[model samples]
Target: MSARHIILCINVGSSSCKFALYSVSGGAESIVAEGVADRIGSSGGKIRVRDANGRSIAESDRDLARPQVAVDALFDEFERLKLPRLDVVGHRIVHGGAHHVAPEIVTPALIADLKRLIAFAPLHMPGGIEGVEAVAARHPKLPQVACFDTAFHRGMPERAERFPLPRELWDAGVRRYGFHGISYEYIMQALGADVPTRLIIAHLGNGASMAAVENGRPLDTTMGFTPAGGFMMGTRPGDLDPGVILYLLEQKGYDAAQLSRLVNLKSGLLGVSGLSSDVKTLLDARGSNANAAMAVEMFCYQIKKAIGALAAALGGLDMLVFTGGIGEHAAAVRAEACQGLAHLGLAIDPRRNDSNQDTISAADSRCRVRVIPTNENLMVARHAARLVFPAG
Candidate 1:
């Protein structure tokens, strides 16, 4: 366990297998290689592989119509590079359900248990589970770890985790289990003790959510029961009223599956703007399209509202960190979000925001705001190595 070991961390994106090879030794890690097999299940699949120096060594197009196919393509590319022998594998498992609150060794029994929770995270689990199984099948004896995205929020109080549903439903595992643990873990590690005691992390991507943390521990998060419950995503409605759901099914004669698709796929900014889900596209069209302008306004409005609500939950916000796709580069969105939040002593410096500094808030701003990129793949690798080779 003390010797240098190579770990491959596979993060199962919606349509890609993102992997990074890390060399871990003496309690430190260095990147060995990284890249992705993208466009899975599509005809125009692409693969890109890079070496430790961050240079692309292999790039090609192939049929990545399945997880196995995509993974196999990655391996074929890696073979030419002749990387170190893999010691173990780590998977970015999105939902671990009730049983796993930390990184766990992957086993057949555990896989079975994990698949049972797929219905809870329908959009995320199937693809992730497929990637995990495909890797295990390829290397039967290779030690593997399942790092749960829900593990970070497991420490949240019952009051925060529980829904107001019936006791029976709660017992049946219908409760809030926030995601993005891997990203939050890396962010906390990077921030170290300098991180404020009360903090909020806004991970704004196509699939977005926010986390309220106290002393580096998650207290509450926007996502609940499923990823679909969180903030308005690219295509999913956030925090919808139950009455609307009942109305959709009972009055409109929509079935359960159809209702699920409505919220999970056809709603959100796409539904409102009748255009692309990408925020940049919406921003570009805002000047010309009324619907796109309204969509942008709503998106920022929702983020501002969530910041206020989370600040209230934390008693007050000391530091606000933004990550993910939209949180990192969308300065206009950031400005729009912080426009009315100056009342909370959160001021966005226009120059700093535009420049993309690590700290985007004004020097005198009471609540500091930062832009810290997330490294969930590295988090997965660390977790996998720890579980694969436990401390004495």
Candidate 2:
């Protein structure tokens, strides 16, 4: 009998830290426990933990004023619950930059490299780096691995990877490094033997992007250079014309910080609607609120346009996948996006789509459309297991 190894996967977001414990043994894996420390650095912060069976093991409001505090609370909950010892820790790192394309054991050198690349992902990298540091401070001896979200697209062709910039810029690592790679990888694994030759995955959520994959490999992706460069998101205006930025700098007198704040925080659905960034909230109010309606329409339009573009990139479409928060649950959004895509041989069965079925495409449609829930934490755990127990 093979010994079981416990792996803890950590994903640090802007205002939350989600974690899960997975037990892997003899080529099988199962969740042991999972939890989140949310509203960090804000009032009414809370941490909640639950067992594998969905029973609440611990839940309480605490002053999670910092990432360190959240990390401490998570460890405390584990100890209080008397959970199995963690053999390894894994992190979902947003950007691996030019190098670090694979999961690697955490080290001072790796930490230093990540810190340098923080400029590449200002809103995301800090939390990930802080998570690593916090884990090191609490349990220095435990091994931690980083699974990058950009690693899955590292194999993209140069035409897809390169920006239409000067040679110096491309040489300086200023090229397309798509995000949501961990989620895409998980979707591919979930597809298993059914994986198609031409695939397009639309990971729609607050931070949305699409990828064109050919025969289990990435050909191109919607996002470029940074997460903010994709389709419009919950709080971002993706793929703005350079002229707009130049005008903002020259005429509006906006500085780099101000531009970053505008594009990364103020824009997107929230900016357009002048309301909440939550898609459900906007969708519910779209009937009465014109701004809300426009926001939702714009989002769906972008999704539709990207589908066409990616299908062209792949020369054709075999399968289309919808994952992430909006992709999995928003039936209306899916319908609107695929409204006129029959030309691509894609047709959504209204009944199946409304019910949120796994395979929602019509039987006669040549392109198979699926809704597969993404498990990035599980992907992270698997990467950690591979790095830690290579033979297993």
lDDT of each: 0.88, 0.94
Please give the range of 10 consecutive residues that has the lowest summed lDDT in model 2.
383-392
Residue 71 in candidate 1, Cα distance off native in Å:
1.8
lDDT of 1 at 42: 83
Please state every model's RMSD to the true fold in angstroms.
1.8, 1.1
Question: In terms of lDDT, which candidate is strongest?
Answer: 2
| Residue runs of model 2 more than 4 Å from their true location after superposition | none
lDDT of 2 by residue, 1-392 (tens): 88799999999988999999999997789999999999988999999998999999899999998888899889988988899998999999999997878889999999999999988898899999999999999999999999999999999999999998999999988999999999999999999999999999999999999999998999999998889998999999999999999999999999999999999999999999998788999999999999999999999999999999999999999999999999999999999999999999999999999999999999999999999999999999989989899877
TM-score of 2: 0.98
Highest TM-score against the true fold, candidate = 2
Clashing pairs in 2: none
